[model samples]
Target chain A: MHPINRRDFLKVASFGGLVFASGLSGCASRAAKSEADEFYFVQLSDTHWGFQGAPNPDAKVTLPKAVAAVNALDPQPDFIVFTGDLTHTTDDPAERRRRLAEFKKIISELKVKDVRLMPGEHDASLDRGEAYKEFFGETHYSFDHKGVHFIALDNVSDPAARIGEEQLAWLKADLAKQAADARIVVLTHRPLFPLFPQWDWATKDGEQAIELLMPHRNVTVFYGHIHQEHHFKTAHIEHHSAKSLIFPLPAPGSQPKRAPIAWDPAQPYRGLGFREVEAEHDEYKLTEYPVVKA
Target chain B: MKRRTLLLGALAAAMGSARAEPEVIRIVARKFVFEPAEITLRVGVPVILELTAPEVAMGFDAPGLKLNTEIPPGKPVRLAFTPDRPGEFEFVCDVFCGSGHEDMGGVVKVLP
Candidate 1:
């Protein structure tokens, strides 16, 4: 919540080190100092509310506990974004709506007033996001906050795991409005690049989306379908995946099948948690925190 | 002249049989895989893919061949298409079936 100062600038610069180590340009430091745009947000993804099984026995309590965890943050987050998969998939239309309503009711308890929501394949693909839209307005949209342009994409709704042509055109038009050097953050459920297509980890038309975002100098993508902490890069655009609230999945192609890792009673909620992304100028400092610290 | 006429009639019958019936390939989809993951076909031959998902509703998406369809549980969905070119293509279960849905895909090889 505080503005970027010398200490924060140095902290960000230290990660890369080259640009600032040679000589801290006055122009760069001045831009970091003057702008009150420094802020951080919480990213909670893949809650899977209706999911019940061996992968996560404590599924009922996970979402609520996550809500309490986010509320306890010291400065709190500027906003909270639920990347996707708010609820598990279901064949029954009525049950699907029920899960969405219940999931919404639970997240409503979060202390953060600004909470953003999107749909994962589990929440949208079955019915083409019809039930999900009944609860959450639009599957894809864009907004701006504190000098950062945030774009929430809906790659899961189409079932084929594509962003669709209509949405792609919308993205192109939206990017045209922003400056070339704008700081943009993309939020979605599945990875835009083919992390592992065999496991449905990659979005079908995600390459086109990445191409659209390529022109922008500073662009960071945050997604959650893999249900683990995974990092990838397509050119300069960095893609970071958030941990799931319900269960953790195996590393991409680590095994023959893409099944959920069985829950370990000794370490309940081991790999389940959210993240805090602190933005300072074009640099982002990511802090990973456990759901309840094991 | 009678012998020549008979030969021409038999040739016409053979061509009709070749073009009238398409080859049927049955593929079973379950959990996170297709029964016959890898399939081979001849270019210009019409084929009908009989798809069925035993447990959940799954999708058959062969983007390379522009063939996409939904296979509901307990019911069979038939998709007919003719292989237009000689090359390898990929088909995947576009629907999210379970934890391993991402890996539910196979390659289609077409012979020239």
Candidate 2:
């Protein structure tokens, strides 16, 4: 198992060159500030809402905890992004709907301007993400915040783990709309580059998407599914994977089986956490906070 | 002599059917598609499908045959079954992958 590495700089940015001034010592109060200087957003992934039992006896509670945490942020994030895996997957369409609906209700408690959602395989795979799209929106899409372009691609919806030709074309066209120096952030459930094929950590055709973004010097990716914080770089693009809310998985290839690590009754939700990124100028700062039993 | 020769021919044919081994099919599932989307086999012949997913988790479901199994990343799952009759069966990736998950499918043709 490779240990987590914290080296180099973790930077966040918005279209307006927003940089979060809050460092490891987070803000204690939401003070009125210079809006032009920086902006921040929260990323909560792998909530696994409908999850029940062994791996997370309190699976239902963690998601609400995350929401409450976000709401309590001294300076509320401009928006919130739930990367994927909103609920546990089941073949029954009815069960899937119930889980999705319940998750929506829970997250509604957050106070944010906008909430961008994408599906992890668990929420999309069975019905080809129909439920997810119906509940959320397009599986792959993009929008601009301030001056940065954020593209959310649906790598989990494809069983083969590709972005598909149609989506790829869309991406090419989308990138063409922006300047070469435009700061771009990609959001998806699976890692865009092949992290570890054997563990579904990599997207099958993510390299093509990366190639399209290769021309752009400022590109960053935030994804979930690995259930742990990992940082990787391909070419000039930087990729970061977030921790899951339900349970954590072992490091890549650490165990013969890649199942979720059993919930530590003592630690409760130690390694399971969420991320907050603040962007200023060209520098992005990311901090991860784990869920603790209330 | 003619009768003995005819009897031996029939025995050889019977032995051939008895000793036939099951055909093996290796299936790999990626994001939106499965490799070798079409599989062909003879009716009444036992076949084994070895399934693997290079990334993520997927499921192969053929409701007609009551078959459903998960394809985990970097793991091999073996399934054994025989085509009962000559016909075409469609199997789809039951696991939710991404936008193309529904399109991830293959056809199995069993010949008489």
Candidate 3:
């Protein structure tokens, strides 16, 4: 783990980036020893591989371009996680499976060995995630990396956009084993809070899940579903939504409907991007990168 | 003035009678489509949508109409509302049923 030197810190700070670092501990001020524990993971979401529409004409190459971009990282991310929506929704079961398979094959090219995946409603809700599970293993699971406990919750599987009672129980049991101030990161496909319920931008029982995590002091949630980068907070827990790889959607309730913003001919892939989340203990620094360089 | 008051009372009574019973429409929700996908209704007329999911749990959400409900398997879920405006509104099976769930939506055309 290379310590971020003053030059590297200056370079990131010059870009007026790391907006998430606000109100949290300063990354530059931390001791080099503590920086040794700092590790970042790449988050790419809503690839919607099989999608073909006006929103993104280059859908076929977007995922591959993103994979190439991630592979170009100086020291590759500790791991890579696709928040959800691995494939476009399809009515045919065989086609759905094929899309998932194709999506998996594309991501396999990532240089990162430890790649984690979850499902968005598009990839799951149809068969209650039966096909998604066949490809991605489990819709929701947890793991530990460098003292940070990461929990991936599946809010898309139930179709009603719920984390469900069973998963809530699992979350409760999982949190019970952790300290109140334990560094925890939650990954989900839908916003756990009611960002825009009318547009289905909410998880039906997400409030219940939030209640379960409220007791913990150091909990941050990263999700992807709205297909654009958004930030919110439910008390102390900070929720950040990632941009989709395929296209972008209007801001929460900004429009009467939640349709994909039309692709721009001059500025292709304008609102599509991925993120790198650097975790130094409980504090995080998020840096966004466009799908393609400007 | 007395005649006008009598006429107003009769109009109120007629409106009351209209509200006494609402038109019921039954909609069946399957894997990826809603039966009777396009429905037409009159503005100011009260309607009760009897929604059912024959195979699995589903949802009826028409945000424009402010009607949303869960249609549990083997049970019918009824939602009642009066179309206040005249326009084409959309109601979708918000619950994930299968692969085509995203396209499982119907339009409710409320005639003025």
Task: Report the number of the highest-DockQ candidate.
Answer: 3
Across A44-121, the per-residue lDDT of candidate 3 in tens digits comes to 999998999899999999999999988988888999999999998888899999999899898889999899899999
Model 2: docking quality category: incorrect
Better of 2 and 3 by lDDT: 3
Q: Write the per-residue lDDT of candidate 1 for residues A250-274, one digit (tens) a residue.
A: 9986975677898999989988888
Deviating ranges (above 4 Å) for candidate 1 = A1-35, B1-24, B28-58, B61-92, B97-112
- Provide the clashing-pair count of each candidate structure: 5, 34, 4
Task: Kindly list the per-residue Cα lDDT of model 2 for residues A78-189, writing each as its tens digit.
Answer: 7889899999877678989999999989988888859999998889866778988888878888988765689999987775566789999999999998877777889999
The parts of candidate 2 lying over 4 Å away from their true place are A1-5, A9-37, B1-112
TM value for model 1: 0.77
TM-score: the better of candidates 1 and 2: 1
Cα lDDT of model 2 overall?
A: 0.78
Shift of residue A238 alpha carbon in model 3, Å? 0.5
The alpha-carbon deviation from the true structure for residue A198 of candidate 1, after best TM-score superposition, in angstroms, is 0.6
Which candidate has the top score in TM-score? Answer: 3
Docking category for candidate 1? acceptable
